[model samples]
Structures are given as structure tokens and as C-alpha cells.
Target: MTRGVRGATTVENNEAGEIIEHTRTLVLEMAEKNNIKPEDVSHAFISVTKDVDAAFPAKALREINGWKYVPVMCMQEIAVPGSLPKCIRIMMVVNTDKQQTEVEHTFQREAVKLRPDLLEDVQKDQQK
Candidate 1:
């Protein structure tokens, strides 16, 4: 079955380095928590808030080892009023044998506030 593993993280600035580094961290954690290998990934859809135009989040995904050929896309996230800024979000879809509830989704930095429920799941999983 194919599952979508979600992740989001925030950067302190709009600089390319900051964006890329934070995005890399979020992607890596999402992959690790879900046990997703590059070969298992079908594609990744990444979006950055309007304030983060300094870099393409997809660049970070491609930079990962063995991920060069994986399909990916980048776009600007809808600018909702009062929404979080400097946020990069990713939906990594991959084929896996694990049940849907077994999949792990990660939210890092300030993005953790975006989904406290999922963060709670992560915390519970960490105790296991």
C-alpha cells in the first residue's frame, strides 16, 4: 500500500541555507520515523509558506542520497492570514507494508503547533 507521510518544520529566516537545512532535517526525520527508503518513495510534494521563497524545498529532497531520481514538486503554500510563517511542509508518499496507523508523521520546530494531535502521537510513540 502507498501511504503519505507528512512533515513540517520552520526556519528562522528566509535565507537559502536556513530553508535548505531545516527542510533537510524535516525530510530526514519523516523518512526515518516512517522507515521510508528512497526506492520506496513514489513522490514528494513540498510546499513553503510565502515568506520562504529563498529556496526550493525540493532541492533538499533531491540532495538526499539515492533520492535524485525520486519524483518531487515544490510550490508556495496558501497564505492564510495569521498562519505560521517560514514553514516548509512535505507529503512524502511511499509504498510500505505497515498499516496506516503504524506510519509516523513528524512536525518539527515551530511547526509542532500546527498539529499538536500528531505531536502527541509522536510523543506516545517515543515512549514505546
Candidate 2:
């Protein structure tokens, strides 16, 4: 089965390098915990808010993971009223046998501030 997991993170600044590095670390950690190999990644999509326009977050992941064939994309998040700022979100689809309920999602830093519910779920998972 294939499962989709969502991750959200925040950038301290709009620097491409920093955003890329932060995203790279977050994605890699998610992949690591789920035992998802690079080859198992079907695709990765990154959405950044209007405040971020430095380098594409995907570039950082490609460089950090050294994935030459994995498809990646970066898009602008819809500007909704009262939306969070400096937020970068990632949704990754992985081919795995794990059930959706068993899968782990991550939200960190100020991003956690945006999704305390999701963060609580992750924390609860860690305890189990």
C-alpha cells in the first residue's frame, strides 16, 4: 500500500539555503522514521507561503539526499486570509505496507504552533 504523510516547518528567514536545509532535514527525518527508502518515494511536493521565494525547497532535498531521479516540485501556497507566514509544507507519498493510522506525520517549530493538534498526534505516536 501507499501512504501519504504531511509535514510542516517554518523558516527563520527567506534565504534559499536555509529553507532548503531545514526542509531537507525534516523530510529526511520523516523518511528515516518510516523506514522509507529513497527509491520508495513516489514524489515529493513542497508549498511555501508568499513570504518565502528564495530557492526551491526541492533543490535542497535533492542535494541532501543525492536523489537523482526522484520527482520534486515547489509551489506557492494559496494566500488565505489570516494564514501563517514563513511556513513551508511538504506532502510526501511513499509506497509502504504501513497503515494510515500507523504512519507518522511531523510538524515542527513555529509550524507546530500552527498545527498543535497534529503535533500532539505525533507526540502521542512517539509515546506508543
Candidate 3:
């Protein structure tokens, strides 16, 4: 089955370096948690809040050893009042045997508050 793995992370600053580093961290964590291989990834869609204009988060994945051929797209997230700032989110679709509920969705830094339910699931998996 094909499943989507979602993740979000907050950058400390609007600098390109910070955005890239944080995005890389988030992607690596998602891949690790879900056992996602580059060959199995269909595509990666990345979105950043309006405040984050330093760089496209997808570009950061180019530096990853096996992501050179994976298709990636970047977009601006809808601006919502009181939403998290400097946030980058990614939705990656991959072909895997795991069911939707088994996929790991990660939220790092202040972004963790965005999905408390998923956080709980991750914690449960760790306790197993």
C-alpha cells in the first residue's frame, strides 16, 4: 500500500541555513521512523509558513545521499492567525507494506504541539 508520512519542524531563524538544517532534520527523522527508502518514495511535498521565505525546504533534501532522484515540491502554507512561526511541513508518499495507522508522523520542536495525537502514538511505539 502507498502511505503518506507527515512531519513538521520549526526553524530558529529565517536564515537559509537554519531552514535547510531544520528541514533536513525533520526529513531524516521521518525516514528513520517510518523505514522509508528513497526508492520507495513517490514524492515529497513541502510547505512553509509565510514567515519562512529564506529558502525552499525541498531544496535541502538534495544534499541527502539517496534523495537526488526523488521528486520534491515546495509551497507556501496558508497563513493562519496564531499559527506556529518559521514552520516547515512535509508530506511524503511512499510505497510500503505498513498500514496508514502504522506510519510515523513526526512533529519536532514547537511543531510538536501541532499534532499531540501523533506524538502520543510515537511515544506508544517507543514504549513497545
Best by lDDT: 3
Worst 10 residues of 3 by lDDT: 54-63
Clashing pairs in 3: none
* Model 1 Cα lDDT, one tens digit per residue, 1-128: 99989899999989998888998888888888888889999999999899999888888878988889999999989999999988999998899998887888888899989989877876898899
- Give the TM-score of each candidate: 0.95, 0.91, 0.96
lDDT of 2 by residue, 1-128 (tens): 78887888898999978898889888887887788787888998899999999888888777864576778889999999888899999888889999887787877778877768766876887798
Give per-residue CA lDDT, model 3, range 38-101, as digits (tens): 9999999999999899888887888999999999999999999999988999999999999888
| Arranged by TM-score, best first | 3, 1, 2
Please report, in order, the local distance difference test score of every candidate based on alpha carbons.
0.89, 0.84, 0.92
User: Which number leads on TM-score?
Assistant: 3
Q: Which portions of model 2 miss their true places by more than 4 Å?
A: none
